[model samples]
Target: MPDHQQRIAYLLARYADKTCSREELDELFSAIGQGDGPEGLEQLLEEIWQARHPAPEIDYEAVYRQIKPAVPVRKTIPLKRIAIAASLLLLAGTAYWLLPSKRTGKQATVLIQPAQRRILPATNKAVLTLSDGTTVPLDSTGKQLIQQGNVAIRQQNGQLLYASQPTDGNIHYNKLTTPRGGQFRLVLPDGTKVWLNSASMLRYPTTFSGKERVVELDGQGYFEIAANAQQPFKVKVRDMEVLVLGTDFDVMAYGDENSVNTTLLTGSILVKEGSTKQLLQPGQQAVIDNQDHQLTVKTADIRKVTAWKNGMFVFNDMALPAILREVARWYDVDIVYKASPGAELYGGGIGRDLQLADVLALLEGNGFNHFGIEGRKVIVLP
Candidate 1:
């Protein structure tokens, strides 16, 4: 909406175009230095600077323009892309398979055919921060099984599982934390499974505290609460509280975000922020704002909302800056754009198990853009 946001859209559109000149690249770097760039934009500048010069073999700019009109950037993206690549390792550090080689045509084509990707790398992992402020990193490590009170918990593939029965007067408390670049899944003692996104934290009793199961969550999470009419599962996110009588839904309450969204898949929920209260049913979403109690409800698509838990990054009508923020985390890479933000709000796509390069390629398919990756970070330029 703002000029800066529009500029960011344009910058992302031409990020990978190799024909962007040195002066053009410097202009981008200067614009970003003006503090209008995306969150991690600066970190990606070096990578983007690399692409400012032309590549040897092909003219990347020419290729970009050809695809630009075909995939027009819009105010609101129409088709969504599911871009999460499956983990190269399934679980316990087991390598699933190797990426397809660049081999193509002639002798290579005759030698082997490209195999379909089965499962992509799952960007799921979390840490448990004790109430004492000491955080316990929960990865594929930890003993096979750990017992705390009546809870039988274990870690499988970076997910923490709590298998315990409801008991009276349970007092221990624990928090599940998803770090800046990780996500995780867990089944509570009561069978309410939760998928936590990056930079999130979930706090709960080692056992259900009272008749109602209460938990505190920061950032975003998807929940599938076990059906128990007697005991409603309640989640406290920032100023809002979501109470459900056993339902499947997703909650996005990241602190940095202006509004918290609660999307229901099956069943219903009551979301309350301040004096404001909203009801949501299946295929419905409720938005509660932090600044003003502005609330909006509309038809919901749970699939797009819960795609992350299912191992995909689904974006519908998302801006390039918005999309890249998520990408920076999952791919463990940073991004910088060199063109204008008004170029387009990228229509999202699904890249099942796509490599960092492949994922960027799809975005580049819409415009003249090239990416430079060093270590875990990436930069895009035009």
Candidate 2:
């Protein structure tokens, strides 16, 4: 092998064995970005892949072409992000590159064949429960589900819409619950729009009848509240309350998470837990500790917080277990950890549309962990 090819091969070996230091990883990316000896490098990567998993046939030249054009030559890329990107290129039969642009950087994903299992991604699906204790299953089909008083409940284009007549004397409540591997969009009677993540539920009244338009959320939901200066919009999640007067925000109060995070994208919101209240401005986040109920404010990563709504999974130095927790919810699968995955953090963005096996392949390609699928369970192998 030539000197550059030998260096690249050596770096690949170290990367495969999980022994590459930060500088070495950067050097590896730099070497690849140099685009030296393309044919030799492609052959070398193919040989490595064939040696490990000989059953599959992959076009190394095509894969390399797909990757090389997308990888930005910037040296300022984070180590973990670059590592994950390169791992996807070599092991996952895909590549997710963070390409620099004039505005915010964008993610480019290239996928290949042999995604062994087809466990698909989440879609627009939920169950609606009426105040009269009746349940209605909702999907992407466009049709009127039922009528409650003067309000017409319909599911159209994967969204649940409540078209109401004039305020009747009677007020009823309805709940929309998204199962595992499911998500939904909702338009409340008061004109507020909500995007519910998987394994979440939202309960709201048929109309904004009282002094306040209050709704209850049990999991994650992004809200675009309609301006109602007289009757403020309030979101109740467990013991905490998000008070808003026409704003855009996201509330994540999942049971498995240790904190309730309320991120404000625009306007303002007052996050109150009991007597303690923290007012949040646009681009800020209020985090309430699940244990002690203490609240703290911090600058929010808007992209990461709203990635689900935007059809991406953006991780920034997130640990393996937490990442899998998200995976389990979206794929509607159980995760079994056979051995403890060490304190390795990952950073990148993957499309939420990919199948369970494809997502696992990208993660497992990082070389620190291996995954197996059995029935509806993803096993973390030692």
Candidate 3:
């Protein structure tokens, strides 16, 4: 073997064993990108794939290409550039990179059917409730800016932007709400950006003049607060409050959940629940128990926590009910459980843009339960 091929083969082996460091992973991809043909690292991966699965009936590359036709065969492949393509191709069976989920060493597969009912994914649709109680329907189609006093609110390229003139006296507040099966993005008066998930609402002032910029949030929201050392940004969600000078974080405080979760992605935050306060560092999560009023902070998987904002539904050993709750909110459907799959944990990543049928098919393919879709309702069978 050539020296370069030998190095590539060694890197591929290290990758297969999951022992490749960050620098090694980058080098491996760079080397792969510099080379061509399946005679090198590709063959090594094929051997690893075959060794992992004794079934000779399955041809990895063939099946991968069949599932994802858009991914053309490249002699020289860059891992970052071809990551999604590789993930899609590898997600069909064992050794999947873009899997729906797996838990307790079990993988979840979504069975595709020609006749399954398809419910399209949610879109950027919401309603803006002004201070005067006037509700304005918002969608990606609208281009005009709605003016209220000195503030200009507009939906440009699917994002709601707030540009306001200087004001001294009035602090008019408005609410942005996304109903079931909808989502929206907003740029606050302070240039802070917020992405509201389905069945979520954000209440904020038209201008920030006070000592602190405070907002109220219901359901789930991902925020990128504009830096203001003097004026701390605070988010009041249910019984918990997240205070930060400027940070990127995700807050999940749905009323039905037992606890309120605030996951900080960047910067720091002070999470206060009742009298108990907890400080969170970057990549840390604060969980507030609603019943006991206890607060706890722990390390968080930032990717899984912020997946929804990145247009993916990532489940990390998540319960079926919890997953269904998200499906219910995003797809805007009612879930009637005829049989309970107790304590079953799932792990996987599915595209949030997929149709309802596609998601349900994955659950049904597991053979643990059957699902029936009637209108906007989902019936889970034993």
Residue 53, model 2, lDDT: 47
Provide the lDDT at 120 for model 3.
80
Of candidate 3, the 10-residue stretch with the lowest lDDT total is 94-103
TM-score of each: 0.64, 0.73, 0.78
lDDT of 2 at 275: 98
Candidate 2, residues 44-91, lDDT tens digits: the string is 655655665474555545554444433445555433333334543445
TM-score of 2: 0.73
Which 10 residues in a row give candidate 1 its minimum summed lDDT? 82-91
Residue 215 of model 2, lDDT score: 97
Residue 50 Cα positional deviation in candidate 2, in Å, after optimal superposition: 22
Native-referenced Cα lDDT, model 3:
0.74
lDDT of 1 by residue, 1-382 (tens): 4565456435533434333333443444345434333544433432333344322433334333322222223323211110000110111111111111121211111111133211124355677764456666777555567666566778777678777766656577888877666778888878888988877888887776557999998888889998888889999987788999988889888765667889999898998887878888799999887788688898876656776665556555666566666667666555655544334444334443456555554554444344555455555654
> Which candidate number has the best TM-score?
3
Per-model lDDT: 0.59, 0.77, 0.74
Give the Å error, residue 8, model 1. Answer: 38
How much does candidate 1 score in TM-score?
0.64
- Residue-wise lDDT of candidate 3 within 202-249, one digit each (tens)? 999999987999999999999999999999999998677899998899
Top lDDT hit: 2
